[model samples]
Target chain A: MTMKRLINLKRTEARRIFITYSAVVIAYVIFQVMSSSGFLSSSMRGMLVPICAYMVMAVSLNLVVGISGELSLGHAGFMSIGAFSGVASAILMQSTITNAPVRLALAMIVGAIFAAIAGFLIGIPVLRLKGDYLAIVTLAFGEIIKSILNNFYFGVDAQGLHFSMLTDTTRLLKGGRLIIRGPMGISGIMKIATFPMGFILVMISLMVVFNLVNSRSGRAFMAIRDDRIAAESIGLDITKYKMMAFVTSAALAGAAGALFAMNYSTIVANKFDFNTSILILVFVVLGGQGNMLGSIIAAAALTVLPEKLRGFSDYRMLLYAIILIVTMLGTNNAEIREFFTKLNPFRRKEEA
Target chain B: MTKRIFTCALLILAMSSCAFGAPFKLGGTAPLTGGAAIYGTAARNGAAIAVEEINAKGGDIQFELRYEDDTHDAEKAVNAYNALKDWGMQLSLGSVTSKPCEATAAENFSDRIFALTPSASSAAVTEGKDNVFQMCFVDPNQGTASAQYIGEKGFAKKVAVIWKNDDVYSKGVYDTFIEAAPKYGLNIVSDTTFADGNDTDFSVQLTDAKDKGAELVFLPMYYQPASLILAQAQAMGYAPKWFGIDGMDGILTMEGFDKSLAEGVMLLTPFNADAKDELTVKFVAKYKEKHGEIPNQFAADGYDCVYAYYQALTQAKANADMSAEELCTKMIEQFTTMTFNGVTGENVKWSANGEVTKDPKGMVIKNGAYVGLD
Candidate 1:
């Protein structure tokens, strides 16, 4: 497809975009109003928040896996670090620091930074590995993180060994007993997550990813995806650009994680598993690798689909796999592309 | 290409409908088919049963249950959180233990949604959480509940607590047992921790438990480990009463457990569906009628919570005289009297900490079935 034809596809694409954006906004507003109206139960109303967060995670991870052509199963590690940093910071603000929106913003930034550091740490050694090797490395990274978090002592000893699962909300100083209770988890967190907060943060993350993917850094990464040796032959910094993609992907995952903590009140170790990392990658793949809007749409759809199909309990996963396979087969087939080409009358005229 | 577009569009439209006005949406994250799949799948079934039961009761409310596969990972659960939050689900469920719940709390489950984990028993989930409303008890609560039962019965003066360090849930329970043992005046002379869950040759651990002057050894693990550890403990001639936790609830009914290895063993939980209680008879029959089998406590609690959400909404119905805040107050007020007469017993009330505090009926391993303990 020529640039002109592709650019012209924007017209039809614009309509799709409008439909999607409208659907999301309308659905979000409708749910919020209904929930606030006391029409639904507190638990059902509560599910909306996570659905939005997952959409963002799905979209951001897509930027790396889909756009940059790298399989990163370790993104959850960065997210975990980000969650602790963000939540710990937010906890500090609620307890010791002066409470303000700036505190949350700063905490989110720090949390993203923490996640970025993690991404860099992992990316430094393993971005060189491709395909299954890369997947295995990333998967191992996730497992290692789980082990560490399972064993993490978020508190210190007598030298002010800050302890307790209630990081800082609820009862800050309780009966001289600081429950650094390592495995217990960080509890008593503040829930500052409103739809507006989650919406804005997600928007920013989406925007950042969108903008980055269109930049020179993006092209380099895309080139790396096409042919790393060829791109490197032209003196493209494969190591740097790959690491860049890895770091940015981690940063977004971390930001989402931090926002997650900000929305909820506690943290546990089991929440970030290898399967989750793979699921995010699934979004990137299912969304049409390298397509931004595709990822967003996929994320939103997957989030709500399983819930709607909750009635098909055991068959739920079967449906998910089916959907993934069908979509992949449907899109990647040459016959389908040929059919579309034949349908488009403007296509043959271009060669003429 | 055309088909992909059509399919995607159709999916988009369908998903929006599910998100907009579905009733009783229970958002839960579990390791549906992973290492924790045994428990996770059962928990998923528990959730599925709850959804089925609620809808079957004349389809009471207009709520939907949105389940996100957390794969038991905390970070990915953040996505589950976002998905649940975006969909505006009321109550969140699933995640059998601390990891996902911890990830959930970290991801902000407390503010966005009222979480009631049917299986998570980590002490961290309840210690300070106001929004984490777990349907099940925490480690300390479950541990103490069991300890009190064991101690009250004067089960033994000396106890050997065998646990695996690799698993946080096991460790948390053991830690609580250790702390509560001193209170109960039980001498925990021998506490052995294993490295792997698959290590069936617990000769060293069993030997240690035996040497520690154990009258009973508390082994809290899954079916495979529990069976392996039990056989090893028996072969070692330890003969200490093999006391464990709910892990053995259903295992008692499983055939793999040698009857010789299982006699006189005690396990503890609040409710077992096999019990002959009035609630148990009805709930189990109803649940089995729908799901085609006996429901575990997880399934029962999930059913109760989902229905409870409907009940709460009905009571919370924006009162004509009251504002939204007043309506919430009314709902919260009405929720207090809410007694879910599920296959388990009543779980209608929420504690000050937002956790369900009603005790489950007791169970003990007899042959392999988790028979009700009198």
Candidate 2:
């Protein structure tokens, strides 16, 4: 009887994964068809890659905030790290790696590695803190990263790469190219990110998150989240599980950051600030914590919502705030949640 | 359902009216709601006034001006550009800020759309983008011009430079000023830097310049920090001859600022509101009546951008029916060769590299009003 129940749970999980993958693939196919036929507006077309990047970000952030039940406010810091490192690597390999896709992949790998290292370092001390303290420290770390990037300068020349802080002390030889200028950030970057790459990144992120959530480590993370004392008595390595989730989330955010950074001609450190972390957190919360598919949908919808409201012009942001508030209230309200669950045909069948 | 249908019909009718209009669709982006909204609002007002004046004349160069809000963000600027493109925009005003302009300029170049920016002074906005032209002097140009003006006029032998090192505009001007100073026989005695958070205090920098026996201090930053620096210098009794660039144009009108402190403060600007020229008089009057205040250099630049476009389009014999790609070529040809006279400057010409070649005017504040220095 236990084996039968375990098989049923496995089957349900498989179906959930299948539904998510199919949904993404179907959406991609529809978007391509619409865009190719010129049915999609230029503004919507421009948002495709960014939407994918945001979806990945939301999914990864969900792993930490939803699955692990930890509130992180420094997610954008890892993203910033990834963006700069990815840009630097792409420029460094410009002559060596002529293939665009190969170079982008390598840049994302490098970005993810750098972000993972930062996450591990931060997680060591940060995991010790709980609740609001963790959130505050993460927020401080995000600001610190932004400040450092604001003063950091990097350049490339025939003599290779040079870096400096607080000044342009990287006085290079003739024909030297500045990769990053303090405050001004990096400009004149080759926009190599495409919608297909963004889609692939999102798929990979979802897969990683889903697999981790169903694994023993993911269970340990949830166990710690539910009851720390009980989890500790059960010999679950609390710190190890928490650190694993945090680092993995950071690595995914870094990859998304690389994709986002490469989509634009220029990027600045200020783009990934406290507001951006809050935005990703909002996505996780609104999508219902621990719901990966919901997170993806929420991210894409919210990203497109503002653009769709452009007809309202000046009042668009105000309207967006209103809608967000309403949605939050509706989702948190028990009666509304019960009504929605009753409206779902799948849930009805399960109950029957 | 009937109400929805009626609304849809009204929307279609409105869109059709826009489609049938003979006016050329002109689109641009600005920070209409952010910290830099002042500049964007001024530029939009100036451009609108110019468009109205041109359309009133019923010339072949009628324009339908549309300005979108970018909130001073580069990403939003690109999004705004795409929206404009979808609206069938032919000529572009680019963007009102330097960073956003740089972002949109890349898109304009790749898409073969001609863009003329008003107040985005960074060189990167036009660098390697032949179709992207500017009305205002580039940052390096202002720096070089400032150095030449002070050196040639013999304003001071020993000059000190205090600039915001973290800002691209300030740094660009400072880099060129130092390079050009030695050539003009100006000795830079002291050089100091400040960043965003630490810009409020300037005593250390002022004292350093004073101790170095400097007679003049050059500030290559905006009016906000310059105002604070001026007040701080006065408090410390280190009153040196103050010189600034175009970024200092709004100092006289800054809210709650003591106009007496700005007395005799000289700056190199493209437009002087106190100028007695007929075009300047007319524009200032119109802008003042509409905006309820004195129009700054950015407004003048916006006005000049529209008039320049008028001259180019009229001379090229361009029509409203021309595609953006065709207009792009015509604009490039005309802009590279034509000489334009507008409120900002006379005989304004653009190089193939898209930099404007116009002399900046030297003006000093007297009794809270700008008086021509030369």
Candidate 3:
């Protein structure tokens, strides 16, 4: 009887994964149909890549904030780092690599690696703090990153890499081309990120977050989140699990950033400042801290909502605020809470 | 069932009315309600007045002006552009600012859509785009003109440059000025910079210029900061010949600004509100009547953009039932060769690359109002 129960539980877990994957695929196919058939407006169609990037950001942030139970206010900093690094790599590789897809893939990998390294370095010192302390440090880091980018000028050519800070003292090799010009930022970036590439990235981000949330390490993360002292006494390595979640989250955010950077011809550091970090946090919070699918839905809806409401013109922002408040209230109200409880896709057997 | 049928009939009638309207619809995106709303409001008012006058004349074509607020954001500007495009708008006056114009014009990769901006001076706004045009001079032209005018008049041999380091417009103009200064026999003695917003304390930079014996200070920023610099310089009793760009056009009328602070402040502008020409008199009076204030350079540019479009259409001999794509092609062909005298009181000509070739007039503030110097 015990063996059969374990087998049935495994089957349910597998079934749950199947359901989420199918849901994402169905939604994507439906969007493609609507876009091609002219049922969706061009404004809505233009938002496909941004929605995907924000979804990845929301889900990855859900890993650290929801499952691991840590608040990070500097997600945009990691994203900026990824954007600059990825764009730098893509610009450097463009002349040599003829194929656009391969270059984009390499750029994303570079972005993710650099962002993971930054997260590791930051997580070592910051993971020791908890609550508001961690939040403040992360916020400061975001500001610091933006200030640094504001002064950073970079180029690449025969010299391999040339850089300067707030001055034109750059020493370039022969035939070197300047890529970044401080506040003017990286212009003329090749637009290689399309809906299909963005869709693949969202899948990768969801896969990482979902699988990690179900693994043994994920249980330890939740234990620490529930009671830190109890988790420590139970012989769980608290920092190890926290760092794992944070670094993975940062890496996924980096990939999202790379996708975002390719969508624009010119991007500046101001585009990824403190407000952006707060915006992403709002997405994670409103989506339900631990809900991956909710984050995806919330991110996509919020990104497209303001654009669809642009006809109102003067009252666009006012209507946006009203919709946000109503949705938040509806999701948190007692009756709706009960409804959502019944619809929870990841509810365990005991909860059922 | 009867109620449902009634609702369905009403919806169908509403849809048909929208589909059958045959007005020449033009759309635009502007800041409308943000830090840059002053410019956006002025641009919209100018365009609105032009459309009203054009329609009132009862030509064969009736024009409609539709605009969406971008809030000075690039992404929002692109969103506005796409929304308008989806609604069957093919010709647009793109966003008011450089970044938003760049964003909106990127969507015009195919020549199927045409964009004409009023006040975005950045050269990148039309870079690599065949269908995009600007009504204002590019930054390099404006900057070079200022330098040449100052040099020829021998205003000052020792000049100092102060600009906003974080702004693309300020940087573009400042860099060109720096490159053109030596050619004009002016020495840039003290080159200093300040960050945008709330960094209003210019005492250090001013003292540096004063101590360096700088006779002129070139400010390539907007009027708000320029006002602060003037006030602070007065407090310090360090007065230099202040020169600014078109961004300084509204300084004399800034609320709470002492009129004396602008006594000798000179700027490069294409529009002279004091011009007594017939078009200038009529446009200024009409704009003042409509907006309760004198029209700024941006407003003048906006007014000119509409007339330029009308001229291009007329020259192309565009008629109803001309496909938007065909009309865009003809407009581009005609716009490249058309020249006109407009409300700005300058003879306007556009190059193939969409650069405007109207020379800016140098104006100075006297007794708290603009007086043309040349």
Candidate 4:
């Protein structure tokens, strides 16, 4: 009976999950190949980490922006919270703590908590505001987080050691550490991240987001996105679902942020500026507003494009902007979408 | 999620701490793979070369070099630092950009993690932190050289300041040019600015300078700005003894600017690859063999920085399993008289402030290629 039920699962449901996951895995492999190739510029190779990190970011964001039908602009803020929490957790393990993995694990958890807290705080105020307002509130939250990071100070070191008078248990953050050295940033960290590590994290985050998005909750979220009034009329409990999506995405952003902070061995306040948030938006929007595979592709493509065009240097950005406009315009037209949709067998089956 | 990562980190840290004890683990954090990977890549390669040479020497202590890519972002620099610390690395080299440099200069990586940045020259790095050490010349030094050369040439009485305003590197150079050019008794009649790192053609700024009757203009910027400004200035026929900073080293070699129009442009470079010195000859040859091009300040800084880190490590591990703190202090002792015939020139002992107390050189763009004017 169980085997028969598994077999009887809707074709689209199984295909949606498999196709999305397979595409991500393949894209990352391609990215790895391109990064190792001799022709790929060194700058682009370095950008892969962010591409990896942002893939996680975009996917988690999709939980809110796409799957849940909510517009969030303050993802960078959650990332900031995750960074501080992760730094604090990592630093605590460094000084008083003995286990590296344990410290990192705890830091990741702490980062999620911080992100969840930040999400809740911002969600109540802005989630209620009608369309586009949520984005503005989230934008403000990102700025506020940056400002807080810039101004906050940790305790003075007794040993005058680089260790910010920060111990992981009591201290919310280690202000004086070399990695997230408060505003200027914490500098000079070791590389714990590789393609494998980044890919693993991205996969885990994607799986979690996918599970949440494909559930009954996910459909309700999508319903709201398509029409919030209709969803509420259908008794979808809009606020509860909105909060759920917001919190889930915040946690994922926090997770990615924590990993990113550890990846750099330094964290600076300015990096979480509005621009970083906007870049994530670009990834999600470029990929296809609600399309996970599209986001992953766009993220990987955009990350590597500038490197391929390094000879152009400053003009590379001009070319990228132009490409973005052209691609968006082309895809917005039904004829172009129809043309591409009919070309791929798998997608054609799904479309039919 | 945090619990899982913390568990793994603890497991790794425990293993690394036990495994890597006593050996000098030299690590670096730089933007090795990102938009600024060019800077970090050169730095990583240079560090690689130095680590190999030092390890090959086979001293009392063994050395392991671990490199972290910061992707030119400050947040990532912290992550790299944590990983190095977990690995029991006492001393580190790198952090190529001003943001990370400034972050460290604010007295972040001290005592436990000693740093000697190969590239960070922002004034902010040196302003506050005593632990942060820099090996390269500052933007002001480049600015001073240009201003002094222009003053010596008797180019013009009025000097103009035209540069990108929010760019820390260019602005640092511009401030130095304006302050020093006036100190040399030259009047700067016009000061013009542009937007972020994108502003190119300087026709408006050049015209303003020309209208202000400025005879010499100090354009301290990167290759993009240099290319646009030089071309536009030539078009406007506003040739006022074009002087520029060191950003013109590599990019100028293949730049499409009307070189014939820029016949008499003077540069106050610390050292040009085209110099006739034996060091320059050897460096340029090796650099071309390895990188297929001459070494710019970025490349030279990368090479010098790795060697400098090796020198410190070698001194620390001369006889004992000492900590990085002990090694860094001992480094200062050896630095008093240490001299390396760097790719640029004979760089002598470093000042306590990390500045290498040495004289620079003048390079003239004669026949379109940069050549040291003796």
Candidate 5:
């Protein structure tokens, strides 16, 4: 009986992964066909890359909030680090890297590395706190990152890259290009991010998250999340697992940031703020904790919902708030949950 | 046979509808529900009034304006721009703020849509976008104009500058003001800077300006920080001739602000609501009746943008059926060559680089109202 139950669990996991992957692939194919055949509106076409980026963000954040059971309010901070560093590296490589895809890939990798380092550093002290304390500290860290980027000035000249704080382009030599102008941010960026690249990034993020969640380290993370005392009694290094999940999440968020930043011609530090962090958290919560496929759907749907309500004019945001409230309430309603379960054909087969 | 006849009738109806005219679709994005909602709401209202009047005029040209809220965010502004594109917008008001305008202006340039922003003063909005134009003075233009006015009018010789360093609008004006001050023979006594999260107190900055024996203090920031500085200066008993740019225009209407503190303060703006000109009077009356408040410079800028577009569209003989790309080309040609007279200015013209050529009027606040300085 135990062997049969184990097999059943593995089968369910495999099916979940297959369904998620197929959903992404099918959605991509449908969108591509629609866009090429002029069936998709320009608005929907513009949102494709951002939707993919947000899906990655939601999944990575779910690793920390859902799997690791640590509420992080500074996800956008790591993203900002990734975005600025990626932009800087891309601008620096403009002459050497003529191919847009190669340049964008290298930039995203650089961004991921920087974000991972930042995550490791912040996670060391941040992991000591629990619950609300961790959330507050992360919030402060996010604000600190935003303030730093606001005063950060970077430029590249014949003398190489110039970095400064609290000073404008006057420090840079003449004829040098200012890549990041303090609060003005980086403008005139070549939009190199494509929907296909976004898809690949999302897939990579999903694989990392899924594989990590199924690994021994992921079990240790869940063990700590369920009961820290019991996890510690089992000789588990709580700090190590927590830090592992955090750094990995941060790195993925950084890659998503790079993808998101490259889709726009201009980007500013203000794009990633405390509000953005909360937005990703909302995606995780509404999608259901520990549910990867749900995160992708929630991210895409929420991102498109606002644009879809444009016809409502001034009442757009109000209607959005109402819809969100109703969704939250409905998800929590036991009757609604049972109804959804009844609607699932797979569940029916299991019951039979 | 009946179904075929019905289908033929529907096709003919569609073709006839296409043959006739419809209102030209105009779209804009604004911060209608955020920190800068005042400016955005005012601009939207001002544009709506213009659209209503034009449509009521029963002329060859009519406008259908649609505005989406961006909450003063660049990302949301791009999304709003896309929605407008999907709605078949042929013309745009870019955005109501500088950062968002900069983002949307890039889209306008790439998509070949003509844009005229109401109050995005940042030069970056029109820097490399020939298709994007400003209805207000560019930041550098405002800075130089302020210096020239102060120098020629002999307002004060010793001036101290306090600006927000982290704001592109403030920094842009400050950079140009510093460059032009020397040409006007104005002596700079002190200079100070502040950033976003540190703008609450102004005691330190005011002390420096006061210690330097400055006769005039130049503030190149929005009304929020300016109000704080004004209150702080009054508390410290450091009174100087306060000079401000167009960003200071709304201080009087700010909630919880002491109106007495703003007496004798001067600002450089393109529009004066108190002007007795026929256009100004009519617009002010209409705006007051609709918005229930005095119209700010942003409202005038929005009003002038529509009128300028109206003049251009009339000159080009543009019809509603033209594609946005075709309209863009025509707008580029017409704006570059045509002269416009509106509530904001007389004989306003745009250069090829999308900068407007208009005179900045200096007005001083007296008895809780703006009075013409000249």
Candidate 6:
């Protein structure tokens, strides 16, 4: 009976993976066909990359919030660091690397590396705190990052980088290419993020998150999340696993940031403020914790739904709020959940 | 037999609708229902009125105006651009703010669409774009004009600068002023900054400015914080000659604000609702009659953007039969060579890089209203 139960669990996991992947592949193919045949509207086509980027963000953030059971409010801070570092790298390497794809790939790697280091440094001190303390520290970290980026000005010269703050032009090297200016931010980034590239990044993020969640270390992390004192008594290295999840999450968020930044010509620090962090958090919460596929669906649907409802522009936000409240109530309310379960075709005969 | 006749009738109606000449459609994106709705609603009203007046004159090619609500978001602005493009619109009045304009123009310029923003003042909006244009002075232009005006009038030799630290617009103006002040024989005695939208008590910065014995104080920020600074400074008994740019225009109507705080404040702007000129009087009266309020600089800029487009279209000698691409090319060609006497200013020159060149006039607030300093 135990063997049969283990086999059943494995079968369910396999089935979930199969269903989610097949859906993604089928949707991608249909979108490609429609885009080529001119059946897709321009607005729909424009939404493709952003949707993919947001999906990656949601999935990675879920790893920390849902699986690890720790709330992080600084995801966008890591993203901003990643975006600026990646764009700065691209701008500096433009002379050396003539190929666009190769350049972008290298820049993304650099961004992920920088963002991971930052996460590791911040996680060391922050992991010591619990619950609201962690949340507040992360929030403060995010705001601090924004303020620093706002004052950060950098330009590239033949020698190296020239940096300044508070509009002091005296430090700028002669004839340097100013890449990041304070407040005005980065402008004129080359567009290299296509749908296919974004899809590959999402797949990579999903693989890392899924593998981590299924590993022995992942179980240890979840154990710590369920009962910190109990896990400590059980000799679990809670700090190590928590840092692992956090650094990995930050790295993935960085890659998404690179993709997002490359899609726009001009982007400022204000774009990745506290509101953006809350938006990503909303995606994770509404998607259901520890459900990767649900997060993807939520991100894609929410991003495109507003654009589709542009006809009723005035009531768009109101309708969106109503839909969110209804979905939450339907899923969480006990009576409604029971009523819906009764209508499920997959219910066992005895259970029915 | 009845079904066949119905299908044929439907086909004929569709073909005739396409063949008979449709009105030339122009699109725009505005923050119609968000925090910036005040500016966006005024812009929409101004554009609608311009189209109505133009079509009433009844030219061979009638114009149609359509706008999408972007809510001041960059992504939504791009979506709006794509939607407009799908609707066969090749000309636009705006994607109102700087960030949205940057996002839309970054990718859509290749579609051969002619876009003219009425109030996005950032130089980054149209840096290298060929088809996009701006109808307001860039930050540097206003900065230089402010310095030049103050120097020529000998307003003050010792000036103190206090601006928002984390804002693009405020920083842009402040940076230019810092560089140009010395050139105009003015000394920046005290330079300080505050985080915008966060700080309400600016006693430290104000006290420092007063202690420096500043003859004039420059506030290159919006009216909300500027009003707070004014009230606080008055309470603290520290008064200096306050100068600002167009960002301070809305201070007079600020809810529960002390109107006397702005009584002697001066600013650099292009439009004055109280101007006595014939065109100014006519536009102001018509706008008040229609909208029940005098138009702001943004509304004036919006109205002028439409007239500028029409003037360019006419100067190109574009006919009803011209394709959108041909008409766009003609419009671009005429924009470089001609100057239109617009409602905002006379001889407004549009450069190739999409910067608008017009002399910004100085104004002072008296009895809770803006009046021309000259």
In terms of lDDT, the best-performing candidate is: 5
Q: Which tens-of-lDDT digit does each residue in A1-352 have in candidate 3?
A: 2344335446666655566677778889998889889898878888898898899899989899999999999999888888888998999989899798888888888889988998998899899999999999988877777777777889876757888999656767778877887777777778887888888898888888767877789889999999999999989999999999999999998888888888877777878888889888889988889888778888988898888787787888899989999999998899989897788766676876
TM-score of 3: 0.90
Superposed Cα deviation of residue A118, candidate 6 (Å): 1.5
Per-residue accuracy of model 5 over B1-374 as CA lDDT, tens digit each: 99999999999998667543699999999999877888898899899999999988877788999998998988889899998999899999999999999889989999999999999988888988889999999999889999999999998999999998768889889989999999998998999988766889888899999999999999998888999999999999988999999889888888899999999999999999899999999999999999788888988988988988999999999999999999999999999999998988998999999999999999999998888888
Error of 3 at A57 (Å): 1.3
Docking class of 3: medium
lDDT of 1 by residue, B1-374 (tens): 99999999999998676542345455777666555555665666656665665565643355456666666555445556656666655556645656667767544433544566777777666556445566676666666766777787788888887776656577667767877877787888787765442366778888887777888788766556777787877676678777777666555434456766777777776667667777567767776686566666666655666656666666666322333234334544555566655554564467756566676556666664567777
Top-DockQ candidate index: 6
C-alpha local distance difference test of each model: 0.66, 0.89, 0.84, 0.68, 0.90, 0.82
Clash pairs detected, candidate 2: none
User: What tens-digit string does per-residue lDDT give for candidate 3 at B258-353?
Assistant: 989999899999888888888888888999897788888888888888878777776776765676688778878987887877876566887888
Q: What TM value does chain A in model 1 reach?
A: 0.78
Higher-lDDT candidate among 1 and 4? Answer: 4
Candidate 6 CAPRI-style tier: medium
Q: Which pairs, if any, clash in model 6?
A: none
Instruction: Rank candidates, lDDT, best first.
Output: 5, 2, 3, 6, 4, 1
**Alpha carbon deviation, residue A207, candidate 4 (Å):** 21
lDDT of model 2 at position B141: 90
lDDT tens digits by residue: candidate 6, B66-185: 888888877778888888877777577767777788888776576777788888788888888887888888887777788888888999999998888877778888878888988999
The reply for model 1, stretches above 4 Å from the true place, is A1-52, A55-68, A95-101, A128-131, A156-183, A194-238, A338-352, B1-138, B148-158, B164-172, B189-215, B221-225, B231-239, B254-261, B271-363, B370-374
lDDT by residue (A1-352, candidate 2, tens digit) is 2344335456667666777888999999899899899999989998999899889889999999998988999899999899999988898898899999989989998899999998999999999988999999999888788878888999999998899998789998899998888878888888898888988999899879877887788788889989999999989888899999999999998888888899888788878889899999889899989888889899988988987887898898899999999999999999999898788665536553
Interface RMSD of each: 5.9, 1.5, 1.2, 9.6, 1.4, 1.4
Better of 3 and 4 by TM-score: 3
**Ten contiguous residues minimizing lDDT sum, candidate 6 chain B:** B15-24
Runs off by more than 4 Å, candidate 2 = A1-16, B1-21, B157-160, B185-192, B196-215, B230-238, B252-261
Query: Poorest 10 consecutive residues of model 4 chain A by lDDT?
Result: A161-170
